[model samples]
Target: MIELRNVGLKYGDKEILKNVSLTVRDNTIKAILGPSGVGKSTILKLMLGLIKPNKGQVIVDGTDITNMKEASLYSIRRKMGMVFQGNALFDSLTISQNLGFFLRENMKLPEEEIERRVEEQIQFAGLEGYEDQLPESLSGGMRRRVAIGRALIFKPHMILFDEPTAGLDPVSSKKILSLISSLRHNNNLGAVIVTHIIDDVFNVADCVAVLYQGEIIFDDVTEKLHNAQHPFIRSILSDKILEL
Candidate 1:
């Protein structure tokens, strides 16, 4: 489980988040919705302990990681995985290498163990035959799957996705969404998805939180999001103008 309690952040004179509180329960997907530069990604960084909150606590499992030492935070981070928006794969490395890199370099696991874990993750991502292929040689959807596999290699308790379906075609997007839903249901995984795609939220998210002007204006089950009459929420959801 992940919880942000009255979190606030500032950079010089700019405030990115103000009194933001969010909870991602086990076996659930919480989608954070907002336009660009609204600090959606900042919340993920806070949860990962990549950055500190000026006036709040980021609790994961049972530990408050907000002020944890770097050494202590490393242990906490190992329990979480982050999938970046750009698919963040190394073009020079093959799929297997990419999946096993951290386990090999950081965990110092034996070759057989690394190979076993790599193969398992590859199969889980449905990339059985693409193990030796480089990221550049695969389709966009395949590359995205590799990125997901990399995150899943360690079997983290929680995963953070930054725009998982940003540039995929409809078919690929739906496949990724289904994968996320299955991960939550089958593995009892917890996830926080930061996205501007309303359809993505409606399709896979159990809960939705709307962030506007650095504050969350709406937070509840996905079904009740449309009931919000706030201008920012209404403007973003309206299909006629399609501001988002």
Candidate 2:
């Protein structure tokens, strides 16, 4: 499980998150929903120990990582995989190389094992024949799938997604959402998806935490979101997509 206890952050004189608290259990999908520039992605950085909060604690699994050293945090961070908004694939490398790159760089596993893992991710991501192609040749949705496969190659306990469906056609968005849902049911993996799209939340998240003005205004099961009385929540419910 991951828990943020009254977390707060600041950039120079500007505050980003304030008294924000949330918990994500295993084998479930949780979404951090908010408008653009509201520091939604900052929360993922905190969970990974990439940044420290000015106040409060970030607990991952059972360890309190708020003040942990970078070296110590390495082991902790490996427990979760992160898929950035941009697919972040190496444009020069083939799809298979991209999937196996991290294992080759970070682990001392044998060549055979690396190949096995890479093949597994290719099949999982449904990219069997495209393994030899560069990311640039694939469509936006295919690139996103490759990114997700790369993340899952680590076999992390949980996955963190930053705007998983941000720039895709409606069919592509639906496919990505289906892929995320399958992670929990088929792989027994938990996920934290940070998105502004309301339909994306309803499609995949089991629970959600609504962030606004650096504070979490609502946190509960996805169904309860419709019952939230906050004006921002009401406005978002009506808008469906938070372009703000």
Candidate 3:
């Protein structure tokens, strides 16, 4: 489980997040909704320990990880994977090499073991034929899949996704959404998805947290989100339906 307690972040008085609190249970997908520049990405960075929050604590599985040393944080990150907005695959690396590089370099595993793990991740993301291909050669959706493949290669217990379906066509977005949902259900990897896509909440989330401005406006079970009577949520949901 992941817990944020009274978490706040600031950048020289320009606050990015304020008094934020949220809890994400294990073996479930937590769908986060918010507009761009509203600290959604910042929250992920905080959880990853990339940046420190000015106040409060970040707890994962009962550990108050707010002030953990870098060594411990590095080990903790082994159980976490983050997928960025642009897929973030290294342009010069082959798909298989991209996924296998970390395992080979970081774990210093044997060549055969690396090969086996890479093959498994390739099959896991259904990118069997594209192992030798570069990111530039694949479509946008395929690039994201490769990114997902790399994340899965580590067998993370916690997965953080940033805008998994931003700017894609509806069909592609839906397919990616299904992949995320399937991962948690099939692999028991906890997922935290930060996206603006309303359809995504319904399709992929077990719980949803809404952030407005610099604060967490609502956090609840997916089925119970609409019961909060949040004016902003209602507006967003209404607008999303109209777009459909």
Indicate which candidate wins on TM-score.
2
RMSD of 3: 1.9
Which prediction has the highest lDDT against the true structure?
2
TM match of model 1 to true structure: 0.94
Clashes of each: 0, 0, 0
Error of 2 at 230 (Å): 0.2
List, residue by residue over 28-122, the lDDT tens digit for candidate 1: 89999988788999999999999999998999998899999988898888898889888889889999999998888779788999899999888
Model 2 regions more than 4 Å off: none
- lDDT value, candidate 3, whole model: 0.85
Which residue pairs in candidate 2 have backbone atoms (N, alpha carbon, C) closer than 3 angstroms, thus clashing? none
Candidate lDDT values, in order: 0.89, 0.95, 0.85
TM-score of each: 0.94, 0.97, 0.94
> Which of candidates 1 and 2 reaches a greater lDDT?
2
* Better candidate number, 1 or 2, judged by TM-score: 2
- What lDDT would candidate 1 get against the real structure? 0.89
